[model samples]
Target: MPDLRLDTTDLERAATGLDAVARALAGTDTLAGDGAGDLGHDGAAAALRRFAESSTRRRDELGRAVEEFAGHLRECVSTFDGTERSLAEGLGGAA
Candidate 1:
């Protein structure tokens, strides 16, 4: 029989990696704080807070998008592997 590879371990790892990255991004957001500690800095504090808010928002969106893309890739790999297995089984049974 011909070799028909249908491994999905890489895709699964990539999905996990994306999730980890998302979690890391969230961690950074948490670390940014609300600028409460710099309350005495006036303008600088407000500007920093604003920058942090926008950065957190963009990071969250980006992380979510990457996770979603990774999920899609994993699903596709699963479908492909399942289909390959089904085809192989059918052919084996016929033979």
Candidate 2:
């Protein structure tokens, strides 16, 4: 028979990596200090400023999504670890 034990180390590592990715995504702010704010609030420059603002908002939304994904991954790993433990204990008793 083959050994089918669940090893959670890989999942833990993946969760850690996902967390790091989330941090990196959140840390990025490409237009944080862009001069769009200095532009006049009229004419074509106004439209450009609006576009920049929208871009910033989009970036924020994406960062939030990635962070949420990381959180979910971590939660799944924790659940999987607990389930693995339960199965192991149950199986040991049956052996």
- Please list the residue runs of candidate 1 whose C-alpha ends up more than 4 Å from where it truly belongs after superposition: 1-6, 30-33, 36-41, 93-95
Task: Residues 9-67, candidate 2: write the lDDT tens digits.
Answer: 77667767767776776677646336655665556666776776787777778777877
**C-alpha RMSD of candidate 2:** 4.0
Q: Residue 39 in candidate 2 has what lDDT?
A: 62
Give the TM-score (vs. native) of candidate 1: 0.73
Candidate 1 lDDT by residue in tens digits, 33-85: 56545578777777777787788789889988988888898898889877877
- The candidate that wins on TM-score is 1
TM-scores of the models, in the order given: 0.73, 0.65
